[model samples]
Target chain A: MVMMNKEDFKTILKKDKKIIDRAFEEKFKDDNPLNEALRYATDSGKRIRPILFLESYKMLTKKSYLNDEIIEMALNIEMIHAYSLVHDDLPSMDNDDLRRGKPTVHKKFGEDIAILIGDSLLNLAFENSLNLAKNGQRFLDASLYLSKASGIDGMIKGQVYDLRRNLEIDLSYILEVYKNKTSRLFMAACVMAGLLNGLSEDKLKALENYAYYLGLSFQIQDDLLDKNEKNELNILSCKSLDEANSLLLDFNNKAKENINKFKNNDFHIYLIDYLTERTK
Target chain B: MVMMNKEDFKTILKKDKKIIDRAFEEKFKDDNPLNEALRYATDSGKRIRPILFLESYKMLTKKSYLNDEIIEMALNIEMIHAYSLVHDDLPSMDNDDLRRGKPTVHKKFGEDIAILIGDSLLNLAFENSLNLAKNGQRFLDASLYLSKASGIDGMIKGQVYDLRRNLEIDLSYILEVYKNKTSRLFMAACVMAGLLNGLSEDKLKALENYAYYLGLSFQIQDDLLDKNEKNELNILSCKSLDEANSLLLDFNNKAKENINKFKNNDFHIYLIDYLTERTK
Candidate 1:
């Protein structure tokens, strides 16, 4: 809880999560192990990534949600994010046995099925989006941005560094991890939504900046949550508690300022604050 | 090598393989583990799939190779095919130690890099194409077909069946595996090329049928080449050697007949015959 209408925010978040969940279930209705594994991995979550996309699109379009095309784009964003978690928790990757207070995908489904599940979800995102005949250039552009954001220059790069490199090098090194591993996809979600809405070039860049600062804070907060005591490689471990608190506030404020420049900042501003301020 | 004009067939196949190889090499130029693994997995192959696309495109447009856009599509096709191979050889999957007489990606690069390599390549394919601004609806339509052909109803489903289900059930089961596992991507390659050239509905169907029969033969012959001695679930062990040869000839003639319906199939007919007849 924060110094705000806590219950009101919770209600809004729950409603938004359901909407995205229904679309995901609809997108994948086939009765099979892969779908079973896919739906399982995607069943529970904050729906923050998809919500960010929806909120940005809403702000730009002045609509509560989106048309069919953009809605599908939002679904695909969540799907990719879920797949990353599935893969991240794999035995060869993070080797984690639990996530979201439950057995990881590998623990329940086996490593092989878990891997294929993640893979199928990734492909499913593309298949559903590319299969749509009406998205046009916006669709192409969004899909491209989504791929790059998750590929070598984006999420995967962050993951590679985390997995293969020494995380205890310095603060700058840790920041790179947060930026690539975390910020890139966040940036993609907001930026892609703006692209889908045909925002001006300046607005797109602004949206990206907004996601960047918010995402960095989001990653650091995650480190704080997961490792309260902190490791030498983590943001909290490198900085004192007071410093970390001020840093989070700085980023949260910067994110708010970035969106403030946009003409329609209602949903964007609300979502950014929600992402940075919410307690899990 | 098989009977008639072996040298001539070898020269042509080599030439076609070189064309696709150059495109793949050119598409991936970055210096990183991911890029290195991507290039390594794609370093050597017969290039039969991309050749099928090029031949079909040439047959439809009377263009020997392709323009920039179509070439990117072709490269993307090969990239997906290569990614499939890398994943298929994973420790949790087929666990293949060698491919094309060289160490597999997992064996050479370790499992983590190998897994990410496959994933990054998949994303790279879409990034290169969907990122292009000028591809239009034809590009979208072709991408849709590509996803379906390699996704649930296509290669992945076949792979799931292969992994979880018993392939030794019956010849019918084996055929389904061949159709989905091996043939769909081949069908996609040719049909997508035709789609790029804006071929008519009739011609597209014709191209699909031609590739289907040819691809079926190609898979059977591959099983025969790799396991002619009998591997229980393979083509040779499932049937008599005479039956296998008869099956190959039957599919070869049918593929030829399908293309015979097309007016300008000079390259198409030659390529299909080459794919079915060649031995290397």
Candidate 2:
């Protein structure tokens, strides 16, 4: 196994991001208003979700696995992420005009087109995943995991809790929000990789825990960096900056510990530190 | 074999609608804001898509099929339809306050919740469909067809064209919109049934054509009944009322002819007439 130097990890991440960007560009090159909005919505994110999926697959398969199907699955996760961001930035939602320092979908296109684009991206994710799923049961299982992680009981419920978080300020309630909203898709990323690689149940559970901790830590780090001032639910709302930082570290430590079960998990360990420590 | 009389056809339609409504109620019995919005949005719609799917399946298989899996598939299609309506009724879209004589999802709940509920319903559809897809290839194929038919190149594209219909008023453009927005899902309904029943490719094509014509005629009839006054695209805009009526008749007749190859297609033939002649 390659040593997990921070520089090497960054290089791998940059390379993976390029791969995902190229795949996304290829997927939505058609000329239409819908395609234009889709391209705009999916453009130029950090693509952490797909990279997380790719890294998890590498860790589990113990190979530099960059197959087309794997890339397609990663792209599907990214599409779901893009759709969420688009909807979250709608006029009745967060009402933001910018995403990733660029005009948000609703801002660039009209609100109507924004809504259609979000729906289109989500539908495209399923269309592509189902196409891959026709190959075998493993792909279908991976897709099913992705679906559940992003559905009513997962990400959508998190949005509902977030909208009503003012009514309840308890730590357990906040953590539940973070768990469902932020951590569910991340959990799906790792767990989908585990399912695709045919990992044992114990290893899969370990990956799930790893992803859970990693996702929570990542969200906390995001709040720490953004210093979000909105009324939306955030980890920094109740906890002081120092306490939130420590909580991030604790989750990161837990994430690193969970991946210790895998022999080739240097990238996993390095990723925990990389994500939680990143600025901006 | 039972002869398809008009009264018998109406009875079958009502029965099928009830079966679909019951399945929908069972699917969303979970108590939550998201589930509540889902139930409200799906409360009533005549259950046309699922009924079309069920009728197609019956026509092809020549069996009075009421299996749980088939009902689940039908529910999945209805969920997609319900999600579309919820999103379409948003303030930025159609801005409709009433749907099927009730307060729309956005009117009853907040727009943010409505958006989340739409996303949840769409996610739940794929989630359920993927679960069934694990059983075999037929289910997977059907789900894939549903996905493609409702995605960017299909229904979403139709919505996009609709939003920009003022930019172009050509007959071909409107027909394209009708084909993608309206016919695509209906095509998926019948073709999915064909796939599930393992019909031959030729027979599948016939079903696809039948659904296409039926869906177009249904939309024309909808425009006739609703007398849409919005600036949105409608066939009545380009053609006289009498011309639109004759066009509807032509489509219905074509739909009937396409399904003539099936020995048990009396119900399908009667459906074309019932849908086209309905006043409301």
Candidate 3:
């Protein structure tokens, strides 16, 4: 597998971050806590999902359009991701104080505002995606995809299962949780990018497979990093990186085959390598 | 003003409660805390919004179709309303333990589950609405109206404004908040019903004005109830009931004119009287 340096990845990620910042400014005009909560929640992240979306879109279309509509869509996705994180870190949930080396939304703006901000972000996501539809079927499709990913059939249900059940560490249950919580949205992102590019169903399916595996691998790496024996990261202790990595390897092999079916890009090869090799 | 006896109002409310109960059972299959949170949040309310919608529709069309789809749509609205109440009762928000004479959602099922349940309910509302859209364009318009009422430019943003500032009380600020927080959804409910009945635009506009004033009067009543000096329910001590009642009287007069434009129903007249005269 080819490896791409961290510098190149950072460059692309930075460009996406710039786009996200501009979009936030455009969509939220009121200088209130809603905007501040959004800014705080969004600015803390590494922009991983948006970067993946951009990369996958680039793979399919080989060109980027940083227009207002596209940027808004991208930001909307990022904001939803951030909002989920904020709610996840609430005192009643994971009870996390820090996210991505910063205070969580509830920590900074209080829980009421954080709750409203999260709710607002979710609503804004559909509002922004509706614009992408421009009075067409695509807008409807985008809204459907987003609603499904975040709805009971997807992330929220996954989280409910996580909270309700005792950790037996079953492979299937863990895999299902990961697929629903992490991979579903990631898959949607790639599918949406493919849709934007007007790619064939076959190609979109292939890209979805790629994203699914990439998400598994990425999550496993996170589990590994948080499981440092030297200094516990205080994440979930019931899961192991070895188990996670084994699952990732199985999925990654299938994803690589799909990615390979598309035109070979040096960046794609590097992404796969970086994702697979990352310790954190 | 025709004042309905308490027994009559209770009977109507009971019927409405049964409809909402059956809808809840059908929609939420899992009998876990997640489901319980939703049920607890929704089950005990007055069903004022759904009743308003159905009543408004009957006024315009003189035909009642209490089909599964209409019931589901009405339940969906209540669920959305319930979700907002759950979030609003969080410890970092209003921190209220009681709602409608029982434990609030967060109190009953920890804040995390409450938050997630609220999110789930909001998404399910859309899912339910989308199912109704299979009926026709009218359903789509209703869905859009629902979306607008609950979205950032509506209730959620208004909540944000309330949370962000400890402002000196002013009529304009109060009115703006009332419009966004309470009146918008109530107006949407009325308009949706009007759409269902194929009401003329002029009639719809008149109904909207009626609903808006009704909402304002209801909110003033609510604010006054919370300021019950004798009962010591000092949730908001900044304003007195006399002051709030003065505003309510003005709004009630305006709403009375709008209400007269529609052919009168005893229930409608009774509602206006009950809202105007009820004590905490």
Candidate 4:
């Protein structure tokens, strides 16, 4: 298995950036504040979630179905991701002025527009998912999966838990938050992509497990990064990269064991290496 | 046509309150700030939206399907309504301290919890809607209808428009806001009830028209009520309700004519009277 280098990932990111920009222009109308806010939020980000989705899908299938519709779907996921970030960055929440080295949506626009744009992106995600009529049932299932992951039962619930108490919650409680806040959507992405390509249920389930662990590892890595920053003003407490990397190794071992249940492929090995070893 | 007196409406409200309380208790397990915030936002509301849904359904169907599931459905709609109210009451928006004769959710539980609880209620609305499977397609359609109506393209979009600019918006703009903010969900309620009992498409459409007019009138009345309340701060410098009501009369006349297409049942007549003549 050939590992994907940083340059290759950067190339993918660059290509996706162009596609996302075009999708943003088409989906969001001219100068609409909601659209503008969404665009501003999406543009400033690293496009991590969509990249993870596409890369994982490509790893399993060994096919890159890059089209307008797929690009749009990916773009919509990014929009939802961006919307959550905007809402998370609100003055009442994290209250950050800068995100990804750009003015946050609420800072650039007003809070009102930021809220609406976040909302518009959420709805637009459904709208985008509904466009997958080539496989209607798959589309519906994917839409439902994404909706459940993004809604209160998932990310919102985690957010609610975070806000409701001040105690240092246990690892189990934190894992619940991580599952809802991070893992479920990633799982949805993998499962949906597999479903779209007519993967077997067993294979889809295996992919879901892999994605779930990947998500857990991703979040732990994020926590580690934030801890390294150690800014008192930072909303999230971060840990050192070494600590995060060690946890990632544990999570990666679990993911690798899960993935081994399926057919062996170079793509799968590449994915493991890319996700576990690569730094963004 | 005999009018539906306040007593009848109050009876329905009481029933709704009982169900809503039960559902609220079931959803929130912990008595943390988040649960309290959600309760603060939801409890003590008039339950007007759910009442409208049930009463309209009852009037059209002439059957008492006020089962636990139906009541739950009604409660779900109110939860969505309540969630929107909490978000609307945030310091970044209307920033109101008092709602329904008590301190608002943000005032009681802080802004972060208020936002999370609002998101939680929205998710719970969908979860609750899943329980309406006994009504089959009617319930599914109703839930979907409510979801779309409350979503960004519906009420949230109108709010976005309202907050974007402070200029004197035209009657068209105002109508857009009113239609999205009020009429769409009201229309969904009527349509949902009509569908529940297998009403004809023509009748459902007519009922929707009636609901649209009623919603417009309701908004006008609410604006007037707010304007008359000397203690409340004015959010907008809008035209008087008398002027708005005059325009609403045009729509109300059309609704009345549409109502005549249905059978001359006492319930239908009562609905028309209540909708057309009610000040609050």
Restricting to chain A, the TM-score for each candidate equals: 0.91, 0.96, 0.86, 0.83
Worst 10-residue lDDT window for candidate 4 chain A reads A230-239
Q: Which of candidates 3 and 4 is the stronger one according to DockQ?
A: 3
TM-score winner:
2
DockQ of all candidate complexes: 0.56, 0.82, 0.41, 0.30
Tell me the tens digit of each residue's lDDT in model 1 across A1-280. 1323556556767887888888877766776546777778888888888878877776677666456776778788887888889888887788789898999998998877777777787787777667543456676677778888888888888878877777356678888888988888889889988887788998898899999998998877776666653222477667877888788889888998889887656555666666666576
Cα displacement (Å) at residue B134, model 3: 5.8
Off by over 4 Å in 1: A1-7, A166-168, A228-233, A263-267, A270-273, A277-280, B1-9, B228-232, B264-266, B270-273, B277-280
- Give one digit per residue, the lDDT tens place, for model 4 in B174-270: 7788888878877877777777777888888888887788777667656655666543222234555566667666776776777777653344345
Residue-level lDDT for A38 in candidate 2: 78
What lDDT score belongs to each candidate, Candidate 1 first? 0.78, 0.87, 0.71, 0.67
Ranking by TM-score: 2, 1, 3, 4
- Cα lDDT over the full model 4: 0.67
Best-performing candidate as measured by DockQ: 2
* lDDT ranking, high to low: 2, 1, 3, 4
Winner of 1 and 2 under lDDT = 2
- Per-prediction TM-score, chain B alone: 0.90, 0.96, 0.87, 0.83
CA displacement after TM-score superposition, residue B115 of candidate 4 (Å):
1.5
Error of 4 at A25 (Å): 2.8
**How does candidate 3 fare on TM-score?**
0.85
